[model samples]
Target chain A: MGLVNSIFATVQFEILRVLTLRRLSVAVIMALFPPTMIFWLQAGGALASPGFIITLFCGMVCLLSLLLWSTSNVYAELEGKSWAFITSRPYGRWSILFGKFLVAFLVSFIISWIALSLCMLVTGDLDFNILNDGKEVPKMQVWLALSGLLFLASMVYAAIFSLLGVLIQRRAMAIAVVFFTVVEVVFAVIPAVVGKFAMSFHMFCLLTHWVGWVPPSAGQDEDANEILQDFLNVYGRQDAWVHLAVIFAMTLLSLSLAAYVICKREYITLEDSQV
Target chain B: MIEFHNVTKLYKTVIGVNDISLKIEPGVYGLLGPNGSGKTTFINLVMGQLRPSMGHLSVFGMDPWQNDGLLNRIGLCPAIQAHYPFISGLKWVAYLTQLRGFSRKQSHQMAAESLAVVGMEYAMNRAMSSYSLGMRQRTVLAQSIAHKPELLILDEPFNGLDPKGRYEMTVFLKSWVKEGRSVILASHILHEVESLNPSLLLVSGGRLLASGSPQQVRSIIANCPNSVRVRCRQTAELAALVTGNFEIKSISINSEAEELEIESMNPLELLKLLPGLAMKNNLLISELRSSDDSLQNIFSMLMLIHRGGMRLPE
Candidate 1:
């Protein structure tokens, strides 16, 4: 109960901090990026396909925003000379970590949702009456499913970035960008067992399952069918529940590791006065 | 309620505090030292923000490192200034109070009360950037005291405060000590802590040079050798006369500046003899200066004495 109160207080402070005009404006600007990109693509006569939206637009925005907010959780306080004040409080470090993680996930997820809403409004993708596997599948349903998966992805990524912040205090953001490029982007696409370790791989796997991938008609596109088969083989044609379980486990594991590392680590903020 | 058992903290090649072993009872203490003399390092170690590189330290009978519960009883008004420009003093204090596990309403009330005690009730609603340095200092003090910690560790708490603020802070600390709570006040200036009449802990070069009451430390400083630099018309005559009559430790004559630097065992007695000796010799003394007046020199002398004791075969 005491820990809960501490976390709640920290959450309140974090919310107050985010609600400031400057920070809110930044958040709004970041949220507008994905929708603006979709609008630009639509103006160029490109289809706002579910696969493109899920993989490129929503995924990139979530990762970037989470990286921006979550990867500096500890570093920002240390740099601002507020770490001593906070860390000296009872249960302060743990509460602040959980509070910041919660806020980071919420802000990133909201940004993605706002971007999706604007994308739907600008591109008219909401009234998606496209057909899949001889059944009329609304693009709106696919988007909603993608949003759910994006929520889970945001939680996992926030935990991962926050853990990175704790582990690498000074260069957390730079290192996280590298991790994104190397692991999420490169390793996730590799056709090997290592791909399964990437959070993006499981997100894509779940995306493929939730939004049914309608294969090309028999004999209509042999090449496309082969490519689809190979892609499925790489990502694995796992059940949606299995992918969901994987994401849940990944989020739990990341959060647990972050908590353990944060609690054990000593943040030495070398201020001018400390000398 | 604090103990350091041969504890040392090293910052790579530089040492923060070296082999410091002492126990602090429940009372106000002045951790006195010059700037960069490891007073902040000692406070950091006690606050559990630092881990000793060697030996052991305990507060409230438990190892202070990572001891969250123990920190509930300790508050620190650090030397560094607060940098939250956009937030009001009230909100900042309240936010930190909430971090102490209080309800939102309760934290606000407690923050307000603490700010009021520190004479910041009016400007608590203003942004911190708009505050004077003294206001910021008081706000930081409010945060440290809001939780009513049993032990308050303040690092240079009087850095930017005016005389009035200093008096109030001293009064508050005196009352706090009277309540049986312990206060460890760290300052580079001697008189800042002298007002509180705290037990003195003189530190220099990361080592505990001396520990005693204010009077005790002052008596030791009195006994330390005093050097007086006298500029006079009869430099050689005065140096010889002073050396002959009094127990002058050393003398150096500077012909260029017409100055005679004299080290005296008893400065009071030498100062008394200077006028009569100068009148008798018909020497006009232009200037008189004492080297032991500055705080740094006093600490250096104490350090020398400490080193001498350490050099003795154990």
Candidate 2:
């Protein structure tokens, strides 16, 4: 119980510091970019497809939320050498790791939801006439599904980056490159079977189904219909659920292992750590 | 109380700590060793940060490695060349107190008091990033004593303190010991530890060379001559008489000042015979000082003796 309290205290302290330093402000501002741009384009009647705007908003929220939360809570802490203060205390190492996980999770979750809410409000106010193709999906249900997928994406990315923060010294650059070049782009181009391994792909597929992008006739356009069918099939598959579950499990496992390593390792001197 | 039984910590190709066995009682214990002599490693082992490769270590009747409960009663002020830039001095101390299980209100109160004790109350609100090296050191000291644990371990506590600050800290540490608590102070500065009058643990090359009272440790230094200075009005007369009567190693007279420096083979006998000699010579003795009993001389002698006697394996 004491350990838990200490961990929470540390998390609160760090969040307060990060917020005060204006470090997260830039990221929070960046989260609004996709929605703002989508709204502006819609106002100008320049938006090609309304469905694409929603997809862009969802992707942007997931990507930006993951990047911001991971950097602030995990990468920044390591670079700041703040762990030394926590590790020197009597609290268990697992408590510290879990505390950080909770903070990053909550921050990303809240920011992503806020961005999605704004996007929904803007689309509703504008009466953009999205989903007018005679496919009846409730607006609230669609928003919920999109939000859920964003939440999952944020969790997986935050966890992976948290582990990277612990294992690698230069974690920020590593996460940035991996997030942009590999997880975001490469996974989208891969086949459904292979793409499910990537967090971004699972989220993209899940959002597509919730938005009712599945076509009626299999012969209308083979490639488009096949992509839509793959989305529906993979979303319902037990294997996809298991993949998300595994990623979540690995996050906990990896974090715990890192905590154990830090607890036992001797910090020979403060001299070795530049931060 | 702390006990180490033939403990050894090895890091791959390098040795962190060699076979070290000692029992520390309730008082100040000075861990005197040069840099890379494993002082920090020894402290980390006691704190359970590092596992010993061989043997056992127990603090307060529990193995620190597996015993989180024992840590509640221990306080540590690590060397302060490293610190978090974003934290304020007060916040740093308060956070550590919170980790020790104090409530937020209680921790804040303790933090304020600890900072005051270390004479850092004025700088409490300032960010550590803006603090000078000496102020940062004081903040570290404040954090260590915030909880007032049964045992306190300080690594080079006086590293960057000015003389006045050092004096204040030494006095506070002395009083802390009087409350039946123990403190283990590690430092390369022998004089700083000497002021605390602590039981000594001397290490070199990752090995414990001697462990006992400062006086006893000084005696372990072999082949080091002890010198005594006697200041009297008739210094020339006393020097001439003493040289003939006793087997004086050497004598030097200060012509400008009335004083005689006598190098003796045995400092203990010289100290014992000083009053008698003063009375016989009818000399008004203003002062009598022994150079060998000083910490600087004792530390140098210990280092020299160890270097001459011990042989490291190639």
Candidate 3:
């Protein structure tokens, strides 16, 4: 009960403080950048298909959520020495870690939902007739299934990044920059099937097929029979569930390990020489 | 009450605390140590922020580690002055109280009362960033006392206070003891602890040196003879006459002033013989003051003895 109160106190304070800061406003704006660009490109006929646009937007949302929760919020808290005050409370260290994870995940989830909503509104891709009209529109059931999968994936991604934020000091910014600039771009260019290891890849795969916002790839029509076989092999088989389970398990393991490390490790003394 | 049975805390290759055993009962107690002498580490151990690597520690009859109920009865004011930058002092105090399970209204009331106790009510509504160092220290103290804890541990509570502020804190702490509450005040400023009149616990190099009443610890030093400075017109004759005749250990002439310092083991005898000695020498005595009995000198002597004892090559 005390741990719950402490967690609520920590999260409430963090959310309020983060919202009040102008830098968070800037981060929110940055999160919208990719979706906005995709919208403009789709309107200008820059994309080969609408399916690509939806995939890119969903991928960006996932990436933005990962970056915002892991880098901006985590770095700000560490620099402010707010964790010292939070950890000093009677709550166990696990409660603190879980509280931070909850805040980061919720914030990222909300931001992604907002971005997704905006993309849907701008693209006018929510029409149910598109699927019945033989436009290869994903069934509503598939969309719901994909949304659940993405939500779980986003939670796992946020947890992993938050743990990374705690373990590595002063690396949040550099990691975020490198992730967005080099790693994300490189992963995006790789074939979608090969991109499953990247969180963005799985998110994009689920989003593109579920929403009619983007059309199927050029080669997908030629290989429709092969694609169906592949989709069944990938999603119908137990491998996909295993992948989700592994990611969830990794998230839980990282969070628990991070909590253990934080609970045991001492804060560097003020008298020590700075790096 | 707090008890440490041979508690030791090591930080990697460094020794934060070593084989420290002591029992503290209800009353104000001062933890006197220099910087990096593990005062904060010791406080952390008591607060369960750090676990002991050896021996055992318990507060309020429960192991501080994994004991939330026991921690509920204790409060800590850390040495660092950093606070959540976004909240007012009142809100910070109220927030902490709420986390401790008080209702919002009760927490607010407690915050106001604690702030009043620290004499920081006027600045309670202001953002913590706007507070001065002394004001921040007072706010920290207010938060520590917000829950009316039985055991209030303050690490360097007097660090940034001015003389008046220090005096106010001293009076507040004395009142706390009057309520039968215990406080563990850690500070390097011996004079500040002296003003608190707490049972002294001296520590050096992660080792407990002495733990007892201030006077008891002061007596542990080798006998420091009381010295008297006397300004007399016939200083040369009086100095020569007083030397080697009346248990006077030594006499020294003040280089910058017309004064003589008479060192003696017995200050009462020296005082009684001063008039006769001055009359015999035909000297007019103007001023007299004794030097070795002050708390500062006693503390220095005690520290010297402690260091000397530690240096016996054990």
Q: Which candidate leads in lDDT?
A: 1
Instruction: Quote the positional error of residue A124 for candidate 1 in Å.
Output: 1.1
Q: Which 10-residue window in model 3 chain A sums to the lowest lDDT? A: A125-134
Q: Point out the worst 10-residue segment of candidate 1 chain B by lDDT.
A: B305-314
> Which pairs clash (backbone N, Cα, C closer than 3 Å) in model 2?
none
Model 2 C-alpha lDDT versus the unseen true structure: 0.70
Off by over 4 Å in 2: A22-25, A35-84, A114-143, A170-197, A214-223, A231-275, B81-88, B119-135, B219-314
Report the C-alpha lDDT of model 3 over A161-236, residue by residue, as the tens digit.
Answer: 7666666657775676575455445764465454454554444444434442233554344354355446545544
Q: Is the docking of candidate 2 incorrect, acceptable, medium or high quality?
A: incorrect
Once fitted onto the true fold, the runs of candidate 3 whose alpha carbons sit more than 4 angstroms away are: A39-45, A49-79, A82-84, A92-95, A124-134, A138-150, A165-275, B101-106, B218-304, B307-314
- lDDT by residue for model 3 (B150-232), tens: 88888888888898898898999889888988889898776788776799898766778778877765545324456788887
Number of the predicted model whose DockQ against the real structure is largest: 1
- Model 2 chain B lowest lDDT segment of ten: B305-314
lDDT against the true structure, each candidate: 0.81, 0.70, 0.68
DockQ metric, candidate 1: 0.57
The CA lDDT at B128 in model 1 is 90
